[model samples]
Target: MRSMCCFSALLLLIMAPVVCQGGNILVFPMEGSHWVNMDVLLQALHSRGHSLTVVRSNKSWYIKEKSSYYNTITVSVEKAVDQKFIQKVIYEIMEYERGASRLVYLFHLIVGMFGTFLESHELLGGFVSALLDDAELTTYMKDSKFDLLLTDPCWGGGAIVAKYLNLPLVYNARWLIAGDAHLAIAPSPLSYIPVTGTRYTDRMTFVQRVNNMILHVITQIQLSWVIKDVYQKVCEKYLGPDCDYYQLMIDADIWLMRTDFVFDYPRPTMPNVIYMGGFQCKPAKPLPQHLEDFVQSSGDHGFIIMSLGTFVSELPADLANEIAATFAKLPQKVIWRYKGEKPDTLGNNTLLVDWMPQNDLLGHLKIKLFVAHGGTNGIQEAIYHGVPVVGIPLFFDQYDNILRLADRGGAKILSLSTMDKDDNFLKAIQEVLTEPSYRNNMQRLSRLHRDQQLTPMDNALFWMEFVMRHKGAAHLKAQGNRMPWYSYHSVDVALFLVGALILLLFTVFFLLRCLCAAVCKCKAKRD
Candidate 1:
């Protein structure tokens, strides 16, 4: 018995280290930005016993700092050539200057494609080229082995690295995946069945249905072009001829979307395309003492929190003056994140700062409304904190995001083009604050949006494990790749109708000819 006990103790000690060493996950987020969602995901994975390695461009400020959650890797890319030089070259080649600039813009598109092909979609081309050429990046890739390559969809390099290393790839889409049917899990109003959960009705009004159909068709065309022209060539170059771009993106072991089903109404979804919505969100943090005092000083009248996010701060001076004037007259105090030089005659009630801790400001109890440019991250934060918004969407997906929020009665959508109109700006602020319905609706959404029993971090971890346990389950997604465009749209019926019409016309022609010939024969006989 003593001998047996000794043997058992030895076995237990031997197996302990093996069980503790979990799989390695490498993460690459977009350069130069602090997307809270990505940060939460990395933290969640770390808690789950997985070792994480985060690779980022030096341009990214987030990576410059250190965190205990994961191992960090920074890749420095070359300074991009001037935008003017790129524009000139593109105009010379394409002979067009509309939309995005020709030269520099074309480089952005091509490099983006190349990055996507390489699976490092987060890193821009200039950055990717710089990293690929860097001795440090090459050395890191050669030495730091990992079990899985996880990346945000914005960075295509993750895909590239996954292909090169022949490792499993997991894509975390900051928004909806624009293309790739496998990753395209949002539901259509026209579809009768719900793809993710069956609790909600999938029906839509006729106009809504038509609009959705058109959007889907347009998305399909655009995605096809991106896959063929951008992703394919890059994949061929890095992954060799045997690799398939469509299959690589579509067949990702897991596609995690950072969107909530409650917000995206009447949309179809799939199991494989996991909706890890609000993964980056957290309960509101306590307000700073000075900010608290500022809010309390406002008394019964509330305040507005204005931020345009990080990327675009080029508000025209006239528009800024107009906003300042509008705030000057309002009863509420305003906290604006303005990067430009401070105006000399700033209103008494308005506080303009070069930077503001957005999440903390929005969480303040005195903040009655939010004024923003409707970026996804900003919108999500506002929604998470139950703050009603006045969204002035500038570009990209901001327009769609703000419109969707407005449609839900949780926010108001205004255009920057008309922001100079003091009446419009003031009226918008009044409507947002006075309207009980908007507040009620926003609170209702907040409940639904926040009711996710699992925080975004937990959801991400759960799905990550789900992928490992079940390798590429069909029940998780629609068979988008198996069907052609005709099949997807049920265009076979239209083809059948056309074929039947042709057959009927031929039959009629044949019958007429026979009757005419018979009549001629009778006439001849009579003669």
Candidate 2:
């Protein structure tokens, strides 16, 4: 009995470190595709023995209230930023794209999106307010003693929650309330680092740089007057009148950025920011029997797979028919993820399903090309698997995402306005398929992406665990997040130097004049 007791004590001693490493993490994630990314992180955390609690809306479209990986705290709200709302907004954007001229489309796009953004924020703000107002929920949260809060800051609620709880904050982020995550945390010069909407590369033409500057100013205005205004009210009411919403945003302990150099242009990044672009991707799993048979039937030709992402389930009927007809003509078989009514023109070679295993299909050796809507996740996955893309950019950052790949010689982009006109979609796909350069360039990128010291997921996990172990990564956090705009940009320093230089010049001029007068007086005296 004493020998068994000694053995048990030894076992406990051996396992103590593993048991102590587990952390209690609180997550406030964004909905739709952002949640997909966050879910991947949550799964990794769960596998590492971390306890997770996800705060989700009652009307959440994708986030389930119950999951094996994490417990959920569901907040009730009058409305949610659900799929239906997004679908309606997307439909409106598509209509504008198809029906209007370029000038009119641009005007309507800006104005319409401006209102939509404000409305979305207002809804998210309301949800946050509801979560905070619930005395029981807030009390429970305080008592839970969560080590840190992980969130996607695309919406402002998570940042507000982290501040309210005084939790060590970490972000699984690419977009913030205003725009791209880099603009919020990094030194993004308008000269090279293109703003979110502009589809310009790092090497911009003179005119493009001028346009970038104009857009940068517009973005600043939108952030200050529009986006920041929504969250400022929330912060003032909940935290205090002294709280700055913008600071709360930039003050995260770590940022797991969903981009890498392979997919994104080189730009300034903060120390706490870790690029985990394709962390969610993995080697291809064996396809379902039916899918494998389909792939095998393609044989030497291989196959093409197209998915426009979660929000765009179906295109307009005419556009769908046009795409279907084009796919029918291709010799290679096509697997399309579409939920719209069957296009009368859809060929026997084309198979339409409601969903497809996107990453798995991308990694498959038999897959030849990807027809995508140019989402960040899709593009990164394409790069990860060495699959070339024929891009159809719909809205938001889709154009910019595709432009990066096109500039890198791995993609062909077709604008929505011209996708159906003169067989543009078909031609783009054919070009990507027939051209050897597209595959070769993308394969090279895949090698570069894979040639990393540590896997992106492993790197992300290390940083997350590091933050938990250290209470917060305060050492890694930059003080720039705490500085005022004038201080951060060094505007005051520049002005001070300019003023001092002017004063010195004036002093020298006055002294020279006095010297000349003295010399003339001496000459007169001598005469």
Candidate 3:
């Protein structure tokens, strides 16, 4: 007993430092569904003994001023990308998509939403300006002695803040200001890698490939324009003329990419990029008694769960009624997260809730299928739990996200245009429910995702701590981000080699002509 006690004391002494080694982390997060994932990340960090401080706009819709896990630094701004703004944007986009022709929809998506997109960035820029310009906030941030800055580069303000503060930067990122986060740092060949909105897969047809290239060019244009118009001016004024906003974004020590090969199409990735897709997912806990009772009532047929994600609280009334009517025909019980008007067509089998424990429900054994808006979080959760999906993609990357699963035979996509025509939505759902391949494919992906030696969350935590242990991970970052476009692409080298080859060819021809002339003159003299 004495020996055991001595050994235990020694172990406690040895493990004390490791257990208590916590770093002060500053976070700059985006609003909407982005915050949902970011909140999960923050909770994980807090649980690991790290201190966190989050910066937010006073009008932020999701980020609370008070929290059990982290401290908040609220910056006052006139305008913000809040719930109202997002809902309005989604409503307009959905309405336009449903009413217009495909080509016209494409034009509307580009031209109609461009102003709103630009305005979102402008609002974010205003928030950033407000935060940095305030002397008190700047002083407080500096005095806080933060070890690192964690941010979602979706808004671009976080990268700028990291530069101004001279902190080691890490990204909890899927999208940067422009498009997919991978495109900014990785060697993405448009031949195979599809752009965000193009919906092309690794094997694209010729026309699709052409569209991919055009979309990629448009993304570049968007990136350049946003940086120049919104972020670059602020960077130049604050971080010096040499501080390029694009470079600052790509210079982060690590990118905790919110996607894995299981969810995302395979592509080239950087050394510093750590794929942590479905990190927010875990085994389901016991559902509330009422919910469990409802789930249990379905018996052998199981149940279907539907959610349209954070931005969409409710869909259009006619669409909702159509969906309800279809669900009324189903044998399985349905639990739908909706805040819209109670549809008159809603059936006895359907339970309408304004909110749900989505992740928990996905993990349940009684789950038959997921009806989703194809948000990254929902799709990734479905993948993690091996639940087959019925994806109704609406706006933005939803189509692309759903198509990835559709190509793999794990999900079925029912576009809004065809959803109501000839009971297409009902047919799509029934097809998925009847198909064994869908569930089997999703389960196979789940196995692949889960077969990792370390959990994705643990992997993310390891890399984050690795960054803190060493002040910054300069060794892992590529210098190509700083290189000029021509130099990085080797266009200058190619031009030089071509010029040299042309000169050599000309010289050889000239020498041959001279030799022929000499030989002809000698022959004439002999004659």
Candidate 4:
């Protein structure tokens, strides 16, 4: 009866009429070329006549233009943050920290990132200050009163801005599932929804569940005590002495996660989380004339596209040489996206370019396999195109992303640390290329992904617009958000059942003892 009542109420809320009007949106892209999903969303919103002003670093990749259609606010972040230093911190921990366990690496990752945050914009004066320090920009924002904030919370700048300006902040994620989502909004079962640090599947072993749960609890503590303190200090310095930091996040509008039920495991989700995994992908464009000729020349053999995305533009020269030699013996033509010095033993069967249209090449009919670092965007694109992959994961979520695809039988994962043995790369390449099953598996995955009733982009836009129209969609916020941990895990219920059982056993034992004593006394009297 209660469930039916709740369902009816929710239906009324959904059916409630809202004014379908446009909004003034402010977008802050994460500091990189990796904002592919967010970029797609922004373009779609722009096309629908919402006024958008995007803030990004000068070093970032954006469509260069000046137009009333949308605006760009450039801030110089090169002096504020070092990309190479950040990358090195994560890489060294993942690669050379052999003495440390995965959990220890996660701890160190948090510590390293925390220190990095303290040194960077989450301070009194840095890149963030640059954004607000601009008198013209701040004045314009104050006047404009942006109705919504589209931001990547991983960057930390967005959350600060949303609180400072009192705007509705919608968090954007590239490929991470963090604990903050569980504590802040959803009911995340740690046994199924693995932490960002671990690569456990939906069905986790007992030990894996224990570790994931520990990570989940510890992450919230770190956020509450460590990260939140720094953010509060920053807010106090700029916003006001009485500024509310964490509440801004806990009460934020929505979470635009780049996840789909097709790619990810079945798990509970919040009303605010909108999953649109393949938003970045589009219908494949016709190949360039030169590339068309190159692919055509492969004849019976096909080609492969190899890229580790923008963050990993270079590799060790020795590793590059080995990769080139491995591809040389294969019948497939390889388009290797290498920005470093060319390997001396590079072969004629390979075409080396600094940049390749990865999605387009994957869509090509003759493209056999993807040689990737297992970035989420690359994985999604490969799934979209029905191409099997040879994954060379480097750091962070790359290994995890590959794990998911490999689990689905469409990709084979190779460890970058053990790439010294030539057979590791060669065997993986040969297996994925020769096995028809890999191809068939990927095609099945593609069908599942492409079979959505509403297109991923349309689904994303609808939820976002719905939120905007409904004045932040508080009606959609889950009522269970504030339930205590014990209730969430059913710990209280278990305790109650145990207590009741103990009481019943004690009562039965006492009654038996009384009866035995009474019977003994009566027998004694009769004797």
**Best-fitting candidate, scored by TM-score:** 3
What are the per-residue Cα lDDT tens digits for candidate 3 across 283-397? 9999999899999999999999999898888888999999999999999999999999999999999999989999999999999999999999999999999999999899899
lDDT values of the candidates?
0.65, 0.90, 0.92, 0.75
List, residue by residue over 1-527, the lDDT tens digit for candidate 1: 99999999999999987766566777766533334567767776787688888876555554544778787777656443233333333333222212345345335433433333333322254454455566776677767777777777654556766766656677787432353233344334445422221112245455655655554565556556656655666677667788776666655667777667656544455666667655665666777777777778888897888987665444556667777888888899888888776655469999887777788778777779999987777788777888899987654456566766787898887765565555888899899899899888888887888776677667667777665455334465567654655977679978999999999999999999999999999999999
TM-score of every candidate? 0.75, 0.96, 0.97, 0.82
- Scored by lDDT, model 2 comes in at 0.90
Clash statistics: count for each candidate: 29, 0, 0, 0
How large is the C-alpha RMSD of every model relative to the true structure? 7.4, 2.1, 1.5, 8.2
| CA lDDT, candidate 2, residue 508 | 99
lDDT by residue (139-252, candidate 4, tens digit) is 888788788888876656677777667777777764322343544566666768887667777778999999888777766766666345456666676788776666555665
In lDDT terms, which candidate is top?
3
Candidate 4 is scored at a TM of: 0.82
Residues forming the 10-long window of minimal summed lDDT in candidate 2: 220-229
Ranked by lDDT, the better of candidates 3 and 4 is 3
lDDT of 2 by residue, 1-527 (tens): 99999999999999987876789999999989888888999999999889999999999989999899999999999998889889999999889988888778767766658888788888999999999999999999999999999999888889889989999999998888778888987888889999888778999999999988987887778777654668999999999999888888789999999999988999888899999989988888988888888888998889999999879999889999999999999999899999999999999888898889888888888899999999988999999999999998888899999999999999999888899999899898889999999999999999999999999999999999899889999999888888888999999999999999999999999999999999999999999
TM-score of 1: 0.75
- CA lDDT for candidate 1: 0.65
| Better by TM-score, candidate 4 or 2 | 2
In model 4, the worst 10-residue window by lDDT is 174-183
Tell me the deviation in Å of residue 278 in model 2: 0.3
By how many angstroms RMSD does model 4 differ from the true structure? 8.2
Alpha-carbon runs more than 4 Å astray in model 1: 1-21, 32-34, 65-67, 79-143, 174-229, 468-479, 482-527
